[model samples]
Target: MSYDTEHVRNPGGAPERITGIPTFTELLANVDLASLYTDIYLSTATTGPELAETADVSKKTAYEYLRKLERAGLVSETGDSDGTRSYEATAFEMTFTVSDVEVSITPELVVVIAHADEFPVIERVLEERGLVTFALAYDLVVAHSEGNVTVRQLATLTDLSSGTAYDIVEAIYEIADLGDDDAGPTTYSPNDVADEPTDLLEELTDE
Candidate 1:
Protein backbone atom coordinates (compact mmCIF):
# COMPACT_ATOMS: atom_id res chain seq x y z
CA MET A 1 0.00 0.00 0.00
CA SER A 2 2.99 2.21 -0.24
CA TYR A 3 3.10 4.74 -3.09
CA ASP A 4 6.49 5.26 -4.65
CA THR A 5 6.94 8.50 -6.52
CA GLU A 6 7.64 8.05 -10.25
CA HIS A 7 9.47 10.85 -11.96
CA VAL A 8 8.56 11.67 -15.54
CA ARG A 9 11.05 13.80 -17.46
CA ASN A 10 9.64 16.69 -19.41
CA PRO A 11 10.29 16.22 -23.13
CA GLY A 12 11.62 18.67 -25.76
CA GLY A 13 14.59 19.69 -23.62
CA ALA A 14 12.25 21.47 -21.24
CA PRO A 15 12.95 21.63 -17.52
CA GLU A 16 11.24 18.86 -15.63
CA ARG A 17 8.53 20.38 -13.50
CA ILE A 18 5.52 19.41 -11.51
CA THR A 19 2.46 21.48 -10.67
CA GLY A 20 -0.02 21.94 -7.80
CA ILE A 21 2.15 19.96 -5.44
CA PRO A 22 1.10 19.70 -1.84
CA THR A 23 3.77 20.30 0.78
CA PHE A 24 5.07 17.46 2.91
CA THR A 25 3.35 18.94 5.95
CA GLU A 26 0.04 19.30 4.13
CA LEU A 27 0.36 15.86 2.66
CA LEU A 28 1.07 14.27 6.03
CA ALA A 29 -1.70 16.10 7.82
CA ASN A 30 -4.29 15.60 5.08
CA VAL A 31 -3.36 11.94 4.71
CA ASP A 32 -3.28 11.27 8.46
CA LEU A 33 -6.61 12.96 9.13
CA ALA A 34 -8.04 11.61 5.89
CA SER A 35 -7.40 8.05 7.09
CA LEU A 36 -9.38 8.64 10.26
CA TYR A 37 -12.24 10.27 8.35
CA THR A 38 -12.13 7.56 5.73
CA ASP A 39 -12.57 4.96 8.44
CA ILE A 40 -15.78 6.65 9.49
CA TYR A 41 -16.84 7.16 5.91
CA LEU A 42 -16.48 3.48 5.07
CA SER A 43 -17.52 2.04 8.42
CA THR A 44 -20.56 -0.19 8.59
CA ALA A 45 -21.18 0.60 12.22
CA THR A 46 -24.76 1.68 12.87
CA THR A 47 -24.53 1.99 16.62
CA GLY A 48 -22.12 3.12 19.27
CA PRO A 49 -21.09 -0.38 20.30
CA GLU A 50 -20.72 -1.48 16.72
CA LEU A 51 -18.71 1.58 15.80
CA ALA A 52 -16.49 1.24 18.87
CA GLU A 53 -15.70 -2.37 18.12
CA THR A 54 -15.12 -1.73 14.42
CA ALA A 55 -13.02 1.39 14.90
CA ASP A 56 -11.19 -0.17 17.88
CA VAL A 57 -12.14 2.83 19.94
CA SER A 58 -13.87 2.80 23.28
CA LYS A 59 -17.65 3.00 23.23
CA LYS A 60 -17.57 6.41 24.87
CA THR A 61 -14.92 7.51 22.43
CA ALA A 62 -16.99 6.18 19.60
CA TYR A 63 -19.96 8.23 20.69
CA GLU A 64 -17.69 11.22 21.00
CA TYR A 65 -16.34 10.70 17.54
CA LEU A 66 -19.84 10.23 16.22
CA ARG A 67 -20.84 13.50 17.79
CA LYS A 68 -17.91 15.19 16.12
CA LEU A 69 -18.82 13.63 12.80
CA GLU A 70 -22.42 14.66 13.27
CA ARG A 71 -21.43 18.23 13.93
CA ALA A 72 -19.16 18.05 10.95
CA GLY A 73 -22.25 16.88 8.99
CA LEU A 74 -20.92 13.39 8.27
CA VAL A 75 -23.31 11.31 10.38
CA SER A 76 -26.80 11.43 11.77
CA GLU A 77 -29.30 9.45 13.82
CA THR A 78 -31.13 6.91 11.72
CA GLY A 79 -33.17 4.88 14.15
CA ASP A 80 -33.23 3.15 17.51
CA SER A 81 -33.32 -0.50 18.53
CA ASP A 82 -33.57 -2.06 21.95
CA GLY A 83 -32.94 1.24 23.66
CA THR A 84 -29.74 1.85 21.67
CA ARG A 85 -29.79 4.69 19.20
CA SER A 86 -28.76 3.73 15.68
CA TYR A 87 -26.72 6.12 13.58
CA GLU A 88 -25.59 6.14 9.99
CA ALA A 89 -23.22 8.15 7.88
CA THR A 90 -24.89 11.24 6.42
CA ALA A 91 -23.03 10.95 3.08
CA PHE A 92 -20.10 13.31 2.53
CA GLU A 93 -16.94 13.43 0.46
CA MET A 94 -13.55 15.07 1.01
CA THR A 95 -10.72 15.66 -1.42
CA PHE A 96 -7.32 17.39 -1.35
CA THR A 97 -5.64 18.08 -4.64
CA VAL A 98 -1.88 18.00 -4.95
CA SER A 99 -0.60 19.61 -8.10
CA ASP A 100 2.68 20.66 -9.73
CA VAL A 101 4.69 17.97 -8.00
CA GLU A 102 5.92 14.44 -8.27
CA VAL A 103 2.86 12.98 -6.65
CA SER A 104 2.20 9.37 -5.92
CA ILE A 105 -1.44 8.97 -5.03
CA THR A 106 -3.63 6.03 -4.22
CA PRO A 107 -7.29 5.67 -5.15
CA GLU A 108 -7.99 4.88 -1.52
CA LEU A 109 -7.85 8.53 -0.59
CA VAL A 110 -10.64 9.57 -2.94
CA VAL A 111 -13.32 7.19 -1.81
CA VAL A 112 -16.64 9.13 -1.60
CA ILE A 113 -17.84 12.62 -1.05
CA ALA A 114 -20.92 12.48 1.14
CA HIS A 115 -21.84 15.49 3.22
CA ALA A 116 -25.25 16.12 4.79
CA ASP A 117 -26.99 13.59 2.62
CA GLU A 118 -26.92 16.18 -0.16
CA PHE A 119 -26.47 13.89 -3.18
CA PRO A 120 -29.57 11.92 -4.10
CA VAL A 121 -27.62 8.91 -5.33
CA ILE A 122 -25.57 8.76 -2.16
CA GLU A 123 -28.61 9.17 0.05
CA ARG A 124 -30.43 6.44 -1.80
CA VAL A 125 -27.50 4.06 -1.56
CA LEU A 126 -27.02 4.66 2.16
CA GLU A 127 -30.73 4.34 2.72
CA GLU A 128 -31.12 1.20 0.63
CA ARG A 129 -27.79 -0.62 0.84
CA GLY A 130 -26.29 0.69 4.10
CA LEU A 131 -22.65 1.57 4.63
CA VAL A 132 -21.15 -1.91 4.39
CA THR A 133 -23.03 -2.79 1.25
CA PHE A 134 -21.46 0.12 -0.64
CA ALA A 135 -18.24 -1.74 -1.27
CA LEU A 136 -20.05 -4.76 -2.63
CA ALA A 137 -22.38 -2.61 -4.69
CA TYR A 138 -19.51 -0.57 -6.09
CA ASP A 139 -17.56 -3.64 -7.21
CA LEU A 140 -20.63 -4.97 -8.93
CA VAL A 141 -21.24 -1.60 -10.53
CA VAL A 142 -17.75 -1.54 -12.00
CA ALA A 143 -17.91 -5.17 -13.07
CA HIS A 144 -21.30 -4.70 -14.63
CA SER A 145 -20.18 -1.57 -16.42
CA GLU A 146 -17.32 -3.62 -17.80
CA GLY A 147 -19.91 -5.96 -19.42
CA ASN A 148 -20.68 -8.59 -16.76
CA VAL A 149 -24.46 -8.34 -16.34
CA THR A 150 -25.53 -11.80 -15.29
CA VAL A 151 -25.94 -12.74 -11.65
CA ARG A 152 -23.98 -15.93 -12.07
CA GLN A 153 -21.22 -14.14 -13.92
CA LEU A 154 -21.02 -11.30 -11.40
CA ALA A 155 -20.97 -13.71 -8.48
CA THR A 156 -18.21 -15.74 -10.07
CA LEU A 157 -16.23 -12.62 -10.82
CA THR A 158 -16.64 -11.04 -7.35
CA ASP A 159 -16.42 -14.25 -5.29
CA LEU A 160 -19.78 -13.38 -3.75
CA SER A 161 -22.78 -15.61 -3.31
CA SER A 162 -25.38 -15.52 -6.04
CA GLY A 163 -27.91 -14.05 -3.66
CA THR A 164 -25.44 -11.38 -2.61
CA ALA A 165 -24.70 -10.53 -6.20
CA TYR A 166 -28.38 -10.12 -6.86
CA ASP A 167 -28.70 -7.77 -3.93
CA ILE A 168 -25.72 -5.72 -5.09
CA VAL A 169 -27.23 -5.46 -8.53
CA GLU A 170 -30.50 -4.31 -7.02
CA ALA A 171 -28.69 -1.64 -5.05
CA ILE A 172 -26.75 -0.48 -8.07
CA TYR A 173 -29.96 -0.16 -9.96
CA GLU A 174 -31.52 1.79 -7.14
CA ILE A 175 -28.55 4.12 -6.89
CA ALA A 176 -28.45 4.72 -10.62
CA ASP A 177 -32.22 5.36 -10.76
CA LEU A 178 -32.68 2.40 -13.06
CA GLY A 179 -35.79 0.39 -12.57
CA ASP A 180 -38.20 -2.21 -13.94
CA ASP A 181 -38.83 -0.08 -17.02
CA ASP A 182 -35.55 -0.95 -18.68
CA ALA A 183 -35.80 -3.18 -21.75
CA GLY A 184 -32.68 -5.18 -20.96
CA PRO A 185 -32.13 -6.98 -17.70
CA THR A 186 -29.68 -4.47 -16.17
CA THR A 187 -26.60 -2.46 -17.02
CA TYR A 188 -24.45 -0.08 -14.96
CA SER A 189 -23.10 3.12 -16.46
CA PRO A 190 -19.94 4.86 -15.31
CA ASN A 191 -21.83 8.17 -15.29
CA ASP A 192 -23.27 7.00 -11.99
CA VAL A 193 -19.82 6.77 -10.40
CA ALA A 194 -20.63 9.61 -8.05
CA ASP A 195 -22.44 7.28 -5.67
CA GLU A 196 -20.97 3.92 -6.68
CA PRO A 197 -18.00 2.95 -4.54
CA THR A 198 -16.02 -0.28 -4.54
CA ASP A 199 -13.97 0.49 -1.46
CA LEU A 200 -15.08 1.12 2.11
CA LEU A 201 -12.51 3.82 2.62
CA GLU A 202 -15.04 6.40 1.36
CA GLU A 203 -14.89 8.06 -2.06
CA LEU A 204 -12.10 10.59 -2.53
CA THR A 205 -9.43 11.46 -5.09
CA ASP A 206 -6.80 14.01 -6.06
CA GLU A 207 -6.84 16.16 -9.17
Candidate 2:
Protein backbone atom coordinates (compact mmCIF):
# COMPACT_ATOMS: atom_id res chain seq x y z
CA MET A 1 0.00 0.00 0.00
CA SER A 2 1.02 3.60 -0.65
CA TYR A 3 2.06 4.81 2.79
CA ASP A 4 -1.46 5.12 4.11
CA THR A 5 -0.31 7.73 6.59
CA GLU A 6 2.12 10.61 6.40
CA HIS A 7 5.41 9.97 8.14
CA VAL A 8 5.90 12.18 11.15
CA ARG A 9 9.23 13.85 11.82
CA ASN A 10 10.66 15.98 14.60
CA PRO A 11 8.01 18.12 16.31
CA GLY A 12 5.60 18.64 13.45
CA GLY A 13 2.07 20.01 13.63
CA ALA A 14 -0.88 17.73 13.28
CA PRO A 15 -1.77 16.35 9.85
CA GLU A 16 -4.71 17.34 7.69
CA ARG A 17 -7.92 15.47 8.55
CA ILE A 18 -6.21 14.47 11.72
CA THR A 19 -7.90 12.05 14.00
CA GLY A 20 -9.54 13.51 17.11
CA ILE A 21 -8.06 10.81 19.27
CA PRO A 22 -5.09 12.89 20.57
CA THR A 23 -2.26 11.49 18.38
CA PHE A 24 -2.77 12.71 14.86
CA THR A 25 0.13 11.78 12.60
CA GLU A 26 2.87 13.64 14.34
CA LEU A 27 6.02 12.08 15.79
CA LEU A 28 4.88 9.39 18.14
CA ALA A 29 4.51 10.27 21.78
CA ASN A 30 5.19 6.70 22.81
CA VAL A 31 7.76 5.48 20.34
CA ASP A 32 8.33 1.99 21.69
CA LEU A 33 4.65 1.24 22.17
CA ALA A 34 3.87 2.58 18.73
CA SER A 35 6.55 0.43 17.19
CA LEU A 36 5.10 -2.65 18.83
CA TYR A 37 1.63 -2.10 17.41
CA THR A 38 2.79 -0.81 14.04
CA ASP A 39 4.90 -3.88 13.60
CA ILE A 40 1.86 -6.04 14.20
CA TYR A 41 -0.34 -4.33 11.61
CA LEU A 42 2.03 -3.22 8.87
CA SER A 43 1.66 -6.17 6.51
CA THR A 44 -2.06 -6.78 6.63
CA ALA A 45 -5.52 -5.44 7.27
CA THR A 46 -7.15 -7.25 10.13
CA THR A 47 -10.41 -7.33 11.98
CA GLY A 48 -10.90 -7.75 15.69
CA PRO A 49 -11.47 -11.45 15.60
CA GLU A 50 -8.58 -12.01 13.24
CA LEU A 51 -6.28 -9.97 15.44
CA ALA A 52 -7.50 -11.74 18.53
CA GLU A 53 -6.79 -15.11 16.98
CA THR A 54 -3.31 -14.14 15.90
CA ALA A 55 -2.34 -12.21 19.00
CA ASP A 56 -3.92 -14.77 21.32
CA VAL A 57 -5.92 -12.18 23.16
CA SER A 58 -9.53 -12.04 24.18
CA LYS A 59 -11.84 -10.41 21.63
CA LYS A 60 -12.37 -7.49 23.96
CA THR A 61 -8.63 -7.16 24.44
CA ALA A 62 -8.16 -7.21 20.69
CA TYR A 63 -10.66 -4.39 20.34
CA GLU A 64 -8.89 -2.52 23.11
CA TYR A 65 -5.55 -2.90 21.36
CA LEU A 66 -7.22 -1.91 18.11
CA ARG A 67 -8.46 1.26 19.71
CA LYS A 68 -4.98 2.15 20.87
CA LEU A 69 -3.55 1.52 17.41
CA GLU A 70 -6.25 3.70 15.91
CA ARG A 71 -5.42 6.46 18.35
CA ALA A 72 -1.74 6.13 17.52
CA GLY A 73 -2.52 6.84 13.82
CA LEU A 74 -0.70 3.67 12.80
CA VAL A 75 -3.99 2.06 11.94
CA SER A 76 -7.15 3.55 10.51
CA GLU A 77 -10.50 1.98 10.55
CA THR A 78 -11.35 0.93 7.01
CA GLY A 79 -14.60 -0.80 7.65
CA ASP A 80 -17.11 -1.10 10.42
CA SER A 81 -20.54 -2.56 10.84
CA ASP A 82 -23.04 -3.27 13.56
CA GLY A 83 -20.85 -6.06 14.76
CA THR A 84 -17.47 -5.78 13.06
CA ARG A 85 -14.67 -3.47 12.02
CA SER A 86 -11.58 -3.73 9.87
CA TYR A 87 -8.43 -1.73 10.38
CA GLU A 88 -5.53 -1.29 7.95
CA ALA A 89 -2.01 -0.36 8.90
CA THR A 90 -0.63 2.92 7.60
CA ALA A 91 2.97 3.43 6.47
CA PHE A 92 4.93 6.05 8.35
CA GLU A 93 8.63 6.41 9.06
CA MET A 94 9.32 7.35 12.65
CA THR A 95 12.31 8.59 14.61
CA PHE A 96 11.88 9.41 18.23
CA THR A 97 13.73 9.39 21.51
CA VAL A 98 12.15 8.37 24.75
CA SER A 99 14.27 9.03 27.80
CA ASP A 100 17.72 7.97 26.57
CA VAL A 101 16.53 5.40 24.01
CA GLU A 102 16.37 6.26 20.33
CA VAL A 103 14.56 4.36 17.59
CA SER A 104 14.30 4.51 13.83
CA ILE A 105 11.48 2.58 12.21
CA THR A 106 11.58 1.82 8.50
CA PRO A 107 10.55 -0.87 6.04
CA GLU A 108 13.98 -2.43 5.61
CA LEU A 109 14.86 -3.28 9.22
CA VAL A 110 11.45 -4.31 10.38
CA VAL A 111 9.85 -7.54 9.17
CA VAL A 112 6.51 -5.75 8.84
CA ILE A 113 6.19 -2.53 6.89
CA ALA A 114 3.04 -0.83 5.68
CA HIS A 115 4.62 -0.21 2.29
CA ALA A 116 5.04 -3.91 1.74
CA ASP A 117 3.40 -3.59 -1.67
CA GLU A 118 6.06 -1.16 -2.83
CA PHE A 119 8.72 -3.76 -2.19
CA PRO A 120 6.92 -6.77 -3.57
CA VAL A 121 10.13 -8.69 -4.07
CA ILE A 122 11.13 -8.11 -0.46
CA GLU A 123 7.68 -9.14 0.56
CA ARG A 124 7.96 -12.29 -1.50
CA VAL A 125 11.29 -13.14 0.08
CA LEU A 126 9.78 -12.54 3.49
CA GLU A 127 6.91 -14.79 2.52
CA GLU A 128 9.29 -17.47 1.31
CA ARG A 129 11.77 -17.45 4.19
CA GLY A 130 9.56 -15.93 6.88
CA LEU A 131 10.15 -12.66 8.74
CA VAL A 132 12.34 -13.88 11.60
CA THR A 133 14.83 -15.51 9.26
CA PHE A 134 14.76 -12.76 6.62
CA ALA A 135 15.26 -10.00 9.19
CA LEU A 136 18.36 -11.77 10.54
CA ALA A 137 19.79 -12.16 7.04
CA TYR A 138 18.79 -8.61 6.25
CA ASP A 139 20.58 -7.33 9.34
CA LEU A 140 23.66 -9.36 8.47
CA VAL A 141 23.77 -8.05 4.92
CA VAL A 142 23.10 -4.48 5.97
CA ALA A 143 25.84 -4.61 8.58
CA HIS A 144 28.29 -5.79 5.98
CA SER A 145 26.90 -3.42 3.39
CA GLU A 146 29.24 -0.72 4.62
CA GLY A 147 32.31 -3.06 4.45
CA ASN A 148 33.53 -6.21 6.09
CA VAL A 149 32.25 -6.63 9.66
CA THR A 150 33.27 -9.32 12.09
CA VAL A 151 31.07 -12.28 12.99
CA ARG A 152 31.05 -10.90 16.54
CA GLN A 153 29.80 -7.57 15.25
CA LEU A 154 27.12 -9.31 13.20
CA ALA A 155 26.21 -11.44 16.17
CA THR A 156 25.69 -8.32 18.25
CA LEU A 157 23.81 -6.50 15.49
CA THR A 158 21.56 -9.44 14.64
CA ASP A 159 21.27 -10.78 18.21
CA LEU A 160 22.58 -14.19 17.24
CA SER A 161 25.23 -16.17 19.09
CA SER A 162 28.76 -15.91 17.67
CA GLY A 163 28.62 -19.53 16.68
CA THR A 164 25.21 -19.11 15.09
CA ALA A 165 26.55 -16.11 13.21
CA TYR A 166 29.48 -18.20 12.03
CA ASP A 167 27.17 -21.01 10.97
CA ILE A 168 25.05 -18.61 8.91
CA VAL A 169 27.94 -18.09 6.46
CA GLU A 170 27.18 -21.46 4.97
CA ALA A 171 23.57 -20.46 4.37
CA ILE A 172 24.65 -17.11 2.99
CA TYR A 173 27.01 -18.84 0.61
CA GLU A 174 24.32 -21.20 -0.60
CA ILE A 175 21.97 -18.30 -1.21
CA ALA A 176 24.48 -15.78 -2.53
CA ASP A 177 24.21 -15.22 -6.28
CA LEU A 178 27.84 -14.21 -6.72
CA GLY A 179 30.54 -16.33 -8.32
CA ASP A 180 32.86 -16.15 -5.30
CA ASP A 181 33.87 -19.76 -4.79
CA ASP A 182 35.59 -18.75 -1.58
CA ALA A 183 32.15 -18.24 -0.07
CA GLY A 184 31.24 -21.90 -0.42
CA PRO A 185 31.46 -23.59 2.96
CA THR A 186 35.06 -22.57 3.38
CA THR A 187 36.74 -21.78 6.66
CA TYR A 188 36.42 -18.10 7.59
CA SER A 189 37.86 -16.09 10.43
CA PRO A 190 35.58 -14.77 13.17
CA ASN A 191 36.65 -11.30 12.12
CA ASP A 192 35.99 -11.86 8.40
CA VAL A 193 32.93 -11.05 6.29
CA ALA A 194 32.52 -10.25 2.61
CA ASP A 195 33.18 -6.65 1.68
CA GLU A 196 30.04 -6.52 -0.44
CA PRO A 197 26.46 -7.59 0.24
CA THR A 198 25.25 -7.11 -3.32
CA ASP A 199 24.43 -10.79 -3.53
CA LEU A 200 21.86 -10.54 -0.79
CA LEU A 201 20.48 -7.32 -2.20
CA GLU A 202 20.19 -8.87 -5.65
CA GLU A 203 18.43 -11.90 -4.23
CA LEU A 204 15.97 -9.58 -2.52
CA THR A 205 15.12 -7.46 -5.54
CA ASP A 206 14.98 -7.28 -9.34
CA GLU A 207 16.38 -3.77 -9.21
Candidate 3:
Protein backbone atom coordinates (compact mmCIF):
# COMPACT_ATOMS: atom_id res chain seq x y z
CA MET A 1 0.00 0.00 0.00
CA SER A 2 1.29 3.45 -0.90
CA TYR A 3 1.31 6.08 1.83
CA ASP A 4 1.48 9.83 1.42
CA THR A 5 4.85 11.28 2.43
CA GLU A 6 3.55 14.53 3.85
CA HIS A 7 0.96 12.80 5.97
CA VAL A 8 2.74 13.46 9.25
CA ARG A 9 4.56 16.68 8.46
CA ASN A 10 1.31 18.57 8.55
CA PRO A 11 0.71 19.09 12.29
CA GLY A 12 -1.54 22.00 11.39
CA GLY A 13 0.97 24.84 11.12
CA ALA A 14 3.37 25.51 14.00
CA PRO A 15 2.32 24.56 17.49
CA GLU A 16 0.46 27.22 19.36
CA ARG A 17 2.53 29.52 21.54
CA ILE A 18 2.75 27.77 24.86
CA THR A 19 1.84 30.04 27.76
CA GLY A 20 5.03 29.73 29.79
CA ILE A 21 7.31 27.66 27.61
CA PRO A 22 9.37 28.44 24.57
CA THR A 23 7.83 27.97 21.17
CA PHE A 24 9.61 25.88 18.54
CA THR A 25 10.88 29.17 17.11
CA GLU A 26 12.48 30.20 20.39
CA LEU A 27 13.90 26.76 20.88
CA LEU A 28 15.42 26.84 17.41
CA ALA A 29 17.07 30.14 18.22
CA ASN A 30 18.41 29.39 21.69
CA VAL A 31 19.28 25.77 21.22
CA ASP A 32 22.12 25.45 18.73
CA LEU A 33 21.42 23.27 15.71
CA ALA A 34 17.81 22.93 16.77
CA SER A 35 16.37 22.18 13.37
CA LEU A 36 18.99 19.54 12.64
CA TYR A 37 18.36 17.84 15.95
CA THR A 38 14.59 17.98 15.50
CA ASP A 39 14.92 16.56 12.01
CA ILE A 40 17.14 13.74 13.15
CA TYR A 41 14.93 12.89 16.12
CA LEU A 42 11.82 12.84 13.97
CA SER A 43 13.39 10.88 11.12
CA THR A 44 15.82 8.33 12.52
CA ALA A 45 13.33 5.69 13.55
CA THR A 46 12.50 2.53 11.61
CA THR A 47 9.04 3.57 10.51
CA GLY A 48 10.12 6.62 8.52
CA PRO A 49 12.51 5.24 5.92
CA GLU A 50 11.18 7.79 3.48
CA LEU A 51 12.76 10.67 5.39
CA ALA A 52 16.19 9.42 4.60
CA GLU A 53 15.16 8.60 1.06
CA THR A 54 13.69 12.04 0.53
CA ALA A 55 16.79 13.67 1.98
CA ASP A 56 18.84 11.66 -0.54
CA VAL A 57 20.85 10.15 2.25
CA SER A 58 21.78 6.65 3.27
CA LYS A 59 20.79 4.94 6.50
CA LYS A 60 24.36 5.46 7.60
CA THR A 61 23.84 9.19 7.21
CA ALA A 62 20.77 8.99 9.38
CA TYR A 63 22.66 7.01 11.99
CA GLU A 64 25.47 9.53 11.99
CA TYR A 65 23.02 12.37 12.52
CA LEU A 66 21.44 10.45 15.35
CA ARG A 67 24.89 9.90 16.80
CA LYS A 68 25.39 13.63 16.89
CA LEU A 69 22.10 13.95 18.69
CA GLU A 70 23.32 11.43 21.22
CA ARG A 71 26.56 13.31 21.87
CA ALA A 72 24.63 16.51 22.41
CA GLY A 73 22.54 14.71 25.05
CA LEU A 74 19.43 15.30 23.02
CA VAL A 75 18.62 11.70 22.07
CA SER A 76 19.65 8.25 23.12
CA GLU A 77 19.75 5.03 21.13
CA THR A 78 17.32 2.42 22.34
CA GLY A 79 17.81 -1.08 20.90
CA ASP A 80 18.27 -2.93 17.66
CA SER A 81 15.97 -5.34 15.87
CA ASP A 82 16.82 -7.05 12.61
CA GLY A 83 19.84 -4.74 12.58
CA THR A 84 17.72 -1.57 12.63
CA ARG A 85 18.16 0.64 15.73
CA SER A 86 15.58 2.50 17.76
CA TYR A 87 15.94 5.82 19.58
CA GLU A 88 14.14 7.94 22.14
CA ALA A 89 14.35 11.69 22.54
CA THR A 90 15.65 13.21 25.73
CA ALA A 91 13.26 15.40 27.63
CA PHE A 92 13.50 19.11 26.81
CA GLU A 93 13.47 21.70 29.61
CA MET A 94 13.02 25.42 29.52
CA THR A 95 12.15 28.34 31.76
CA PHE A 96 9.94 31.31 30.99
CA THR A 97 8.28 34.16 32.83
CA VAL A 98 4.71 34.97 32.07
CA SER A 99 2.47 37.33 34.03
CA ASP A 100 5.26 37.85 36.52
CA VAL A 101 5.24 34.18 37.35
CA GLU A 102 8.45 32.31 36.71
CA VAL A 103 7.71 28.85 35.45
CA SER A 104 9.80 25.88 34.51
CA ILE A 105 8.84 23.30 31.93
CA THR A 106 10.09 19.81 31.28
CA PRO A 107 8.05 18.20 28.55
CA GLU A 108 8.24 15.02 26.52
CA LEU A 109 8.84 16.12 22.95
CA VAL A 110 7.06 12.98 21.71
CA VAL A 111 7.96 13.79 18.14
CA VAL A 112 7.50 10.28 16.77
CA ILE A 113 11.10 9.20 16.76
CA ALA A 114 10.34 6.61 14.10
CA HIS A 115 8.12 8.44 11.67
CA ALA A 116 10.07 11.60 10.77
CA ASP A 117 8.13 13.71 8.30
CA GLU A 118 4.78 12.36 9.37
CA PHE A 119 2.97 12.12 12.75
CA PRO A 120 0.35 14.68 11.82
CA VAL A 121 -2.20 13.31 14.25
CA ILE A 122 0.38 12.67 16.92
CA GLU A 123 1.66 16.20 16.70
CA ARG A 124 -1.88 17.43 16.92
CA VAL A 125 -2.21 15.33 20.06
CA LEU A 126 0.90 16.91 21.50
CA GLU A 127 -0.18 20.44 20.70
CA GLU A 128 -3.72 20.28 21.96
CA ARG A 129 -3.25 18.08 25.01
CA GLY A 130 0.24 16.87 25.81
CA LEU A 131 2.19 20.10 26.13
CA VAL A 132 -0.55 21.92 27.93
CA THR A 133 -0.99 19.02 30.28
CA PHE A 134 2.71 19.09 31.04
CA ALA A 135 2.46 22.70 32.03
CA LEU A 136 -0.71 22.10 33.98
CA ALA A 137 0.81 19.22 35.83
CA TYR A 138 3.77 21.32 36.84
CA ASP A 139 1.56 24.22 37.81
CA LEU A 140 -0.63 22.04 39.95
CA VAL A 141 2.34 20.62 41.75
CA VAL A 142 3.73 24.05 42.47
CA ALA A 143 0.50 25.55 43.64
CA HIS A 144 -0.46 22.54 45.73
CA SER A 145 -3.78 22.38 43.95
CA GLU A 146 -5.97 19.50 42.83
CA GLY A 147 -8.29 18.71 39.96
CA ASN A 148 -9.27 15.78 37.84
CA VAL A 149 -9.29 15.37 34.08
CA THR A 150 -9.88 11.75 33.27
CA VAL A 151 -8.20 9.83 30.48
CA ARG A 152 -11.56 9.54 28.76
CA GLN A 153 -11.83 13.33 28.72
CA LEU A 154 -8.40 13.62 27.22
CA ALA A 155 -9.16 10.95 24.65
CA THR A 156 -12.31 12.70 23.50
CA LEU A 157 -10.88 16.22 23.56
CA THR A 158 -7.70 15.42 21.71
CA ASP A 159 -9.24 12.88 19.35
CA LEU A 160 -6.71 10.32 20.43
CA SER A 161 -7.55 6.68 20.63
CA SER A 162 -8.15 5.37 24.13
CA GLY A 163 -4.94 3.38 24.03
CA THR A 164 -2.89 6.38 22.95
CA ALA A 165 -4.45 8.49 25.66
CA TYR A 166 -3.70 5.81 28.20
CA ASP A 167 -0.10 5.68 27.06
CA ILE A 168 0.24 9.40 27.54
CA VAL A 169 -1.49 9.33 30.90
CA GLU A 170 0.65 6.51 32.13
CA ALA A 171 3.81 8.24 31.06
CA ILE A 172 2.79 11.37 32.88
CA TYR A 173 1.89 9.41 35.97
CA GLU A 174 5.20 7.62 35.93
CA ILE A 175 7.17 10.79 35.41
CA ALA A 176 5.38 12.80 38.05
CA ASP A 177 5.14 10.03 40.62
CA LEU A 178 1.43 10.64 40.53
CA GLY A 179 -1.15 8.21 41.84
CA ASP A 180 -4.86 7.88 42.20
CA ASP A 181 -6.97 8.95 45.11
CA ASP A 182 -10.37 7.44 45.95
CA ALA A 183 -9.96 5.00 43.12
CA GLY A 184 -12.81 2.87 42.02
CA PRO A 185 -11.54 3.96 38.64
CA THR A 186 -8.21 5.77 38.41
CA THR A 187 -7.84 9.48 39.00
CA TYR A 188 -4.40 11.03 39.31
CA SER A 189 -2.79 13.51 41.65
CA PRO A 190 0.57 15.13 41.11
CA ASN A 191 3.19 14.49 43.73
CA ASP A 192 5.40 16.99 45.50
CA VAL A 193 8.46 15.62 43.86
CA ALA A 194 10.88 16.37 41.08
CA ASP A 195 13.02 14.01 39.04
CA GLU A 196 15.79 14.34 36.52
CA PRO A 197 14.85 12.13 33.59
CA THR A 198 18.39 11.10 32.58
CA ASP A 199 18.40 7.97 34.72
CA LEU A 200 14.88 7.20 33.63
CA LEU A 201 15.79 7.43 29.96
CA GLU A 202 18.83 5.25 30.49
CA GLU A 203 16.73 2.65 32.21
CA LEU A 204 14.14 2.75 29.44
CA THR A 205 16.81 2.44 26.75
CA ASP A 206 18.41 -0.44 28.53
CA GLU A 207 15.09 -2.24 28.60
lDDT of model 1 at position 180: 49
**lDDT agreement with native, every candidate:** 0.46, 0.50, 0.44
| Residue pairs whose backbone atoms clash in candidate 2 | none
Which ten-residue region of model 3 has the weakest summed lDDT? 108-117
Q: With candidate 1 superimposed using the best TM-score fit, by how many Å does residue 198's alpha carbon deviate from the native?
A: 29
Candidate order by lDDT, decreasing, is 2, 1, 3
Residue range 68-178, candidate 2, lDDT tens digits: 767767678787766788777766655555454444555334333333433444444445544455455554554444344455555555455656555554344333332
2 Cα displacement, candidate 3 (Å): 58
lDDT (Cα, tens digit) per residue for candidate 1, span 75-95: 567778898877655453233
Q: Pick the candidate with the highest lDDT.
A: 2
Candidate 3, residues 40-155: lDDT per residue as tens digits? Answer: 45544532243344443566765555455566566666677777666665666655666654445443332221221243333344455544543443333222223334554444
Best of the candidates, TM-score: 2
For all predicted structures, in order, the TM-scores are 0.31, 0.43, 0.29
Against the true structure, candidate 2 reaches a TM-score of 0.43
